[model samples]
Target: MANTTSAKKATRKIARRTEVNKSRRSRVRGFIRKVEEAIASGDQALAQAALKAAQPELMRAATKGVLHANTASRKVSRLASRVKSLSA
Candidate 1:
């Protein structure tokens, strides 16, 4: 119940932003999942390649405000470690 016109417009803007954020979040998750799947498959080359692709996407999401910078960096670090261990 947005009583004012400005409130109504703000509500619409929030809804639009929510949808955009959801899409961005889902895209970031997909990239992370690809890396995880590659690691699970025990393909070091594949995991490395996937991480290469995912790192930028994760950082982009952070820049877009969909993820925290530290969170993205941590995810990248953990995934890189797992990928590295695949060769061990």
Candidate 2:
């Protein structure tokens, strides 16, 4: 499908970028899932720690354009609130 040399190069670049982005997305989700699993296990301390670790990963994904900044912030806020409420 990529007839021109430039187009073929572009396609290759896209494939590489797609793989990188997919890895990044999966890593971010793994961090979030750790927080969720900690929360589900009802370990307040563990949940807090997982959320702490996830915050930066979420923000990093946002900065890399994998997620919107607002979405990352909202997720951090919600997770923090839930972690906090676990103490109550």
User: Quick one: best TM-score, which candidate?
Assistant: 1
Over 1-88, each residue of candidate 2 has an lDDT whose tens digit, in order, gives 9999999999999999899989999999999999999988999999989998999999999999989999999999999998898889
lDDT of every model, 2 decimals:
0.96, 0.94
Per-residue CA lDDT of candidate 1, range 1-88, in tens? 9999999999999999999999999999999999999999999999999999999999999999999999999999999999999998
RMSD of each: 0.6, 0.8
TM-score of 1: 0.97
Error of 1 at 67 (Å): 0.6
Q: Where in model 2 is the C-alpha error above 4 Å?
A: none
Model 2 global lDDT (CA atoms, 0 to 1): 0.94
